[model samples]
Target: MDSPTILLTNDDGIDSPGIRALANGLSDVGEVTVVAPADNKSAVGRATSSEARVHEHELGYALEGTPVDCVIAGIEALGPSPDVVVAGVNQGANLGMYVLGRSGTVSAAVEAAYFGVPAIATSLYLPGDRWKTVPKPEEYDEAVRATRYLIERGLDNGLFELADYLNVNAPAPENGRTEMRITRPSSVYDMTANHDGETVTLQDNIWQLMERDSYSEGERTDRQAIVEGVISVSPLAAPHSTEHHDALDDLAAEY
Candidate 1:
């Protein structure tokens, strides 16, 4: 059987070390075409561009746009139709339910899922605020290994039959390869907005909570799994979750 054709992209820009490491690792198992942002587009989830410039890259192509734009161009114009889309080996971990929609890495995978393609978003966990500094390419080995393991068997094993895509987070190589665990995105929310006399500063307090060992997410969540030194793979559907509430139902009926 032929190896899968992969659409590889990242928000860390075409020249980022994380994507380069991921591209090299994936080549061992598939034909990898990288269609990534020409500039770092981090935290810009699912944002698109009406038009983007394409550049020839050593691995594939670079786009002067968001990750979603890269996915579209790769599928529609710049490359072959892919059997799978792999985003990241992102420089920082994308964990928690609240954070997923804000991650360009995960957003790329979500865009692929909408295209009816299997996708996986991979990232390396860097504790605290240390994630602001990108890790060395060698530090991505654990994340690369986990993603490869999934892509090697996921399709044949009926993985995508059950889920649209996967969000994978792994500890850095200092912890070596750990066990893999199936997890859900945690519901923990700790965003805060502080208005100084002049400016409003937004902060994500979840990491601070973790540092204090006070986080409330249980063991089966992505955030906690990484805290315990294991790879977390959350099999997720592409659409935003919806739940019917009784109060809303009553209000509608009364109206």
Candidate 2:
């Protein structure tokens, strides 16, 4: 029997060490093809460029576009559609409902789910104070380990049987032995905007709180789970959350 084909991608560009680690880790399970942005796309979410370009490489294709574009192009124009799509091992963790619409890593997986493909989006959580200035690839071993474990076990074990996609976050290795936990996205949103002279800067303040020893009603959430040295897996779908309204039905009937 042939091994499963996996299409791998990330928001952090094709040359990023995170993707390289993921590719290497997944080598044992299947044939891997990496298609990702040529440059960092990070928080761009599902945005796509009409003038996007693609460059073929020995490992895979690099796109001058958003993470979503890479997945779409890989499925439609690249070689044989993969059995699953795996995005990231991103330098920073993508957690909470607030991040869902702004994370290119998760967006790539969400895009794949729309096509009925099982997908996994993985990221690493680093210490907030040092993350921006001291980011390093060596710190992602635990994240890669979690991602590899998922790919090896998730498919055959029916984890993705009912899930369209999964959003995974692993803590930095300094946190110690990591445990895997099924989790949900947190609802907390802490962001700010400041104007300095002529420019306005947007900052996500939640990271600071996330680095603290305590969290607010976030124990089982992705953010808290990562802080506790655990790999967080959040099963997600493409369906829009809905609510039934009898008032709307009555209004429609009166009309």
Candidate 3:
């Protein structure tokens, strides 16, 4: 293909600095058309709306819905279908297997996979106070660079043929260039509920582990890689699989 058409969307809203940096970084790589949420819709995984409203923007277009809505609108209601769907450069990292259904960033890529279009979902891993502070555009340099590199060089090399989509998480770059490592989502789960009177608060204790450097080491997992300041790239498939068991077969035979 001469110039690939890239469909860009995010849960952080169209005006977010992350998406803006992403669009600017990939501008030279292909024709990018933006169809993103009108306001921050973070963590609303794969949600769709029948009453979505679309409006033109200088960046491209804004959807009064979730990132998933943006993807469907871009593919069906907008103009031409895109060659690839790119999501995020998300405000926060989407790590661990448990987070897949809870992350709008990754969900956008998953939605694209159902349509048979290759996609990449990107995010930055910020620890502690960093999450509360808004990052400047320059802080996104590493993520933008890695994202462009993947689209321009990695995609054509059959990266998409094997995996339905990729979840890329990066830490802030150290000198100039950053290091990337292939990894799987860490199987860490730390959810709890605290009850006081009539109210209950849900919490994920993993944050405390992260703050304490208590996450198990070894760079084989996305959570580990992010903790070590490396970019984590996890190749993911879309299908929900089932395992064959002899007990099920025996039960079926009896029935």
Candidate 4:
């Protein structure tokens, strides 16, 4: 049997240390090809450009497009489709339901899921004060460990049988070998907007709260797990969750 072929990508550009770490980590599992954005497309979600141009390089392809664009181009325009799609080891963590729609790293995995491909999306949670300072590739050991573990066990064991994709976030290395937890996205959102006569700015404080041990629920949630320095793995589906609503149907009859 042949080794699995893995397609790797990220919201950060191809040169990002996060993706590089991920690629190197997965090298032992299979042949890895990385196709990523030419520049940082963080928080762009699944946005794509119909007119975007692509540039080819020795390592992979770079697009003047979003993370979803890279996945589409990788499968449609690039060679031999991969066995699985993996995104990120992103510079910042992507947690909660509120962020799912706005995160390019998660969007890349979602795009793959829509195509019926099992996928993994990874991120590193950095402290707010140090988020501006880039970390070294060696620092990603835990994230890489979790990612490789998923790749090694997820496919062969049918871990993705019930999920369209996965969202994984690792605490900064200081938190030591974080325990793995199966979780659902937390339903919390924090947004602050400020206006000064002429200009307006939107700020999201969710990451700040995510870093604090006091604010998180001690249960096995992504936010809480990362705060405790453990790896968080969340199984996710592509479409919105559905629930039977016979009561709502009866209410509609009155109209």
Tens digits of lDDT, candidate 4, 1-255: 147888899998888899889888988898888889999999998888986787886667888889998898888877468888999989988888889999999999999999888899999888886666788878888999999888888888878898999999988878756678887887777899999999999988877786665786656677877777778899999987679799878999878
Highest lDDT among the candidates is held by which one? 1
What tens digits encode model 2's per-residue C-alpha lDDT throughout 1-255? 147789999998898888988888888878898889998999998898776888987568988999999999889887578888999888878989988989999999999999888899998877765546435667777777877777777778887887889999888778856788898999888889999999999988888886676655567888778778788999988776778899989999999
Model 1 scores worst on lDDT over the 10 consecutive residues at 208-217
How good is model 1 by TM-score?
0.94
lDDT score of model 2? Answer: 0.84
* Tens-digit lDDT string for candidate 1 (1-255): 259999999998999888899899989798889999998999999889899989898878989999999999999998899999999988888998887889999999999999999999998888867688878877888898899999998978899999999999997557534799999999888799999899999988887776555655689999888877889999999988689799989999999
Scored against the true structure, residue 121 in model 2 reaches a CA lDDT of 95
- Model 4 ranges off by over 4 Å: 250-255
True lDDT of residue 169, candidate 1: 94
Alpha-carbon runs more than 4 Å astray in model 1: 213-216, 241-255
Roughly what TM-score does model 3 have, to 2 decimal places?
0.94
How many clashing pairs per prediction, in order? Answer: 0, 0, 0, 1
- Cα misplacement distance, residue 72 of candidate 2 (Å): 0.6
In candidate 3, where is summed lDDT lowest over 10 consecutive residues?
171-180
Count backbone clashes in candidate 2. Answer: 0
Give lDDT per model, in order: 0.89, 0.84, 0.86, 0.86
Off by over 4 Å in 2: 133-137, 251-255
